[model samples]
Every structure is written in C-alpha cells, then in structure tokens.
Target: MASSIHSPNQQLAYQQARQHFHNQQNQKIQIFWSNQTQDIKQMNDFKNHSLPLARIKKIMKADEDVRMISAEAPIVFAKACEMFILELTLRSWIHTEENKHRTLQKNDIASAITRTDIFDFLVDIVPRDELKEDGLGIPRVAFQAGAGSSSDHLPYYYMLPHHPSPVGASGMFYTAPQPCPSLAYMHWPQLPQQEPPKTDT
Candidate 1:
C-alpha cells in the first residue's frame, strides 16, 4: 500500500482550520456602557434627588472597578469619569431648581455644565501622567488643588467617563446586544467634530 502524501491545498486547509480554532478560543465578552440616552435620564433623576453629584463623584473615585482600570487606561477611565461627573452635575442642578418636575430644560443642562467644575478639572486631569500610572498613585492634594485652586467658578463634581470610546458604525453602535442604560450621556454636541481631545500624558 502507498502512503498518502498531503498536498499544498490540504496543508493550507489545515492551517486555516487551526487559525479559526485559535480565533474562537481568543474571543471574549467585553462589558461596557452602551448608551448615553439612559445616562441623560438618570442625570435628570439624579437632579430630582436619586443621587447627588458629590456622592456620584465619591463612587467613581472610590469604586475599585473604576480605579483599577483607570490607572492603565487613562483615556477610557477619564472619559467615563467625565460622563459620570456631567450626569451628577446635571442631576444636582435639576433637583435644586424651582421646577423639579419639568423636562430637562436646555438651560439646566448648560447651567449644570457651567456649575460643575469636574469638566474643566477633567480637561486637566485626563492629560496628566500621574493619574495614568500603575496603582494610580495620584495624590489627593493634587486633585484638591486643581479643583479648588482654579480661579474659574466651575462647581466640582466627579461625573465623567473613566473610559470613553468613539461612536460610529465602525465604532460602538447602539444595539440590542448592548442596551443603552439610563445613566449614559455623551458630550457629543459639546465635543469637537475633529479627533477626540488628546491625552497629554
């Protein structure tokens, strides 16, 4: 009996099969925030009294999950932080206003943005290397100084994205698999149309 020899096509088929197997093995489930619409609603509720800006900031800063990921992935961490802060600020403003039951008035959003110091602080913090370091050994004093010393009249809140990815078909698209939560809001209108703000760190 003659021994069978593998042809080039057979070898190529084998390689393809192996590659597919490996690809399947490498696939993983990545959980992330899927929608900003929900965040807007949550912010409105937060404004109405479910959660406060200060408390939200404390949660974002102290949450082990957020802090652990934030050290190595500053941009993502920063964006998440920014989003959280914005939501908290908006919520706080809505709750304080005379019309608590009204729809999210445009001025309320603007006032929330203006009153919340976290946005500007984020503009500075997101760019710093200290916040990106392993262990995220950022000093408390540094945060306080940046937030407190700034002459700008912005009120401080800790709402912001710890991780922010772009939105597009190629980017993260809103879909059923990833339901949009009530606490997700993107500063899309506020963000420049060009590339995302660069990380200075």
Candidate 2:
C-alpha cells in the first residue's frame, strides 16, 4: 500500500511533502485568480467565452420557470463553472499525489468529493466501487446520526431551493431527512444512486 509510510521521521517527511504540495496548489490557485482578474479587466468581448455560450444558456434555462436569460448571466455562470472545475482538479491532484499515482483516476475525484464539504451534495453520486477502492467508505446519508441540525452537517448553500425541515426527533435530537425536491423536471444530473460515502475518518 502507498501508506506503507510508517516511522516518525518518515511520517514527518510525508507530512512535509503534503504541506509542500498544498503550498504549491495554493500558489497555482492564486495565479489562476490573478489571470482571471487580468482577463476580466482587459477583455472586451462578452459574446465569446471558453465555454460554449449556448450550452450555458441551455443549462440556465433548464429550470422551467426560467423563460428569459441575459447575455451577461451565461458569461457569469461559465466563469463560475470554470473555477469549480479548476478547484476540483487541483483537489483531486492532491489525492493522486497522496496515493503515489501519476495518472488521474476516478477514485481521486471521489476522494476529493468525500473530503470537501462544499461538494457534499455530490456525495450520493460517486460510484460505490470507486469510493470503496479508494478506501474511503461510501457516504450513505446526507447527514450523520448525531445531535445537530442539517446546518451542522452541511454548508449554508446546499440543495438550493429546497431547505431541510425538521423531520422529527431522534430521541432528544432532531435528525434531518434529505430535503424534499421542489421542481420535478429541474433535471439535475442524476447519477445512478449508490450508497452515500462514509463521513467518518
């Protein structure tokens, strides 16, 4: 196993390596942010983008209620999506390095989702086999069986348009059920439902 890394000095060396990896990752993100700033400042063409404007428009109009879209809206969403992909790639690379792998793999992305809280909504979508193979157990539920509200388990922006309501008490504490779906045809990309990844270390 890659984790054959034992011994105090070896552990220290491993941690230091990880820390260095993290520092490099941070620097890359900062550079990206700086480039994005420069692009925003100098770019005059709003009609063209790296992501297809038509595709972005289609995704925005996926909501039945969304009948109209502005030119700027798609541009904004395209940039946001780009940032999300970049961050996910960087985070996944951390897992790849930890596993001593050169090629990026599915398990790396799954590990990134399991470790990142903002990606919590995606936990249900990672395949059971990938999560298990990564040695990070499946996340079977959105929240843990513990004392606290859904707010305790999730970031503030999870499952937009559907807020969690009190789903009765687990003895003295309230356990949150998955939030009820609001629009049936919103067409959120449904991954074949697998057991949710395990939240425990």
Candidate 3:
C-alpha cells in the first residue's frame, strides 16, 4: 500500500491541477448560464450588437443552399459566435495551465482541439504549422473539454460555427486560428437607420 503512494509526483500533480480546473470551471458555468438567462430576459435592444450582422449574413449566404435569411437569424448567430469564443478560450486555457503557463498560447488551443473529440471537427480549421503528430500517430497533447447546460435551444445548437481542421495522413502541424477581435467590438452601425417598411394595407 505504501508503494502505491510513492508514484511519480508529476502525474499526481497533473491530476490535482486538472481537478482544480474542473472545480473553477463549474463556478464559471453557473455564472455563464445566469448571464445568458438575464440576456434572454432583457434582449430588447436589437439595434445594438457586438458583431456585424451584415457580415454574419454574408457568411451565411455563402452556402449555395442558404437563401432568404430571416432578420432574427443573424442575431442568433451573433450570440452563437460569442458562446463559441468563450468555449474555445476555456479549452485553450486548460492546456495553458497544464504546461505551467499563465498565457494562452496558440499551441494550447491546438492541443485542446486535438484532445477534444467534439472539437475534432475543428482540426481542419487550425493551420498545419501549429500541430504535429506525436510518436503514437496522434496530436501531441492530452485533455478533455466539457460543457454543462440544460437550457440550450435547438437553433442555438445547429447555428454554432464549427470549422475544425482535419488531421491528415501527413501528420502535419495545425496552428490555432487567430481570434478576430473586430467581431466583438463591431458596435458601429454600418447601415443608415431607415423607417420601418410600409404595409400595403
């Protein structure tokens, strides 16, 4: 029994470190949900948005099958983008902590993507220069990603933009995509505020 307790401290430390991370994340999830609930309850300000609705609509329209988007769709997509950013950052932060670093490096995000099955969809999105396969033919990282929620709507789930870089036969390195700060601060109204459309009645 005493021998079992003498295992390598590095492994023990990592276990403890991740446990602490999970604990803190639980608290964050609670606050996140609370804020989302509040936003849903008080979402009357359609005129103001953190992301450019026009750009979002343009992206959506790029798909050949997508035509005639509703006014509410862009608003939903903006919220989804915000949530995506939060999730990506949260996963990357875990890798940063594992490496005993405070700053979230691009590698941390790449590692997170490789380790997370759900984020597997994003493997293709990461640049080839950022990630390389380990000796075991796997991305050189280890970890888990999780989300807690009971109130997510169906459209919200379907609308989240997922662009995981694909792991290829070459075992190439995949770099994390740069975050677009402009999206979150695009508060300026690009279009002129015109009167509501007239009805034929």
Off by more than 4 A, model 3: 1-17, 127-201
Best model per lDDT: 2
What would you estimate as the lDDT of candidate 3? 0.66
Candidate 2 per-residue lDDT over residues 28-128, each given as its tens digit: 76887798789778978877667998987986776655888987898989878887888888878876876689998887787777667778777777632
TM-score of each: 0.20, 0.57, 0.54
- The best-first sequence of candidates by lDDT reads 2, 3, 1
Error of 3 at 174 (Å): 26
Tens-place lDDT digits, model 3, residues 97-196: 6578989887777666765556666776663242357555555432232221221100111232375456545787555644555576778778978999
Candidate 2 yields a Cα-based lDDT of 0.68
How many clashes in each structure?
31, 7, 17
Worst 10 residues of 3 by lDDT: 148-157
Candidate 1 TM-score over all chains jointly = 0.20
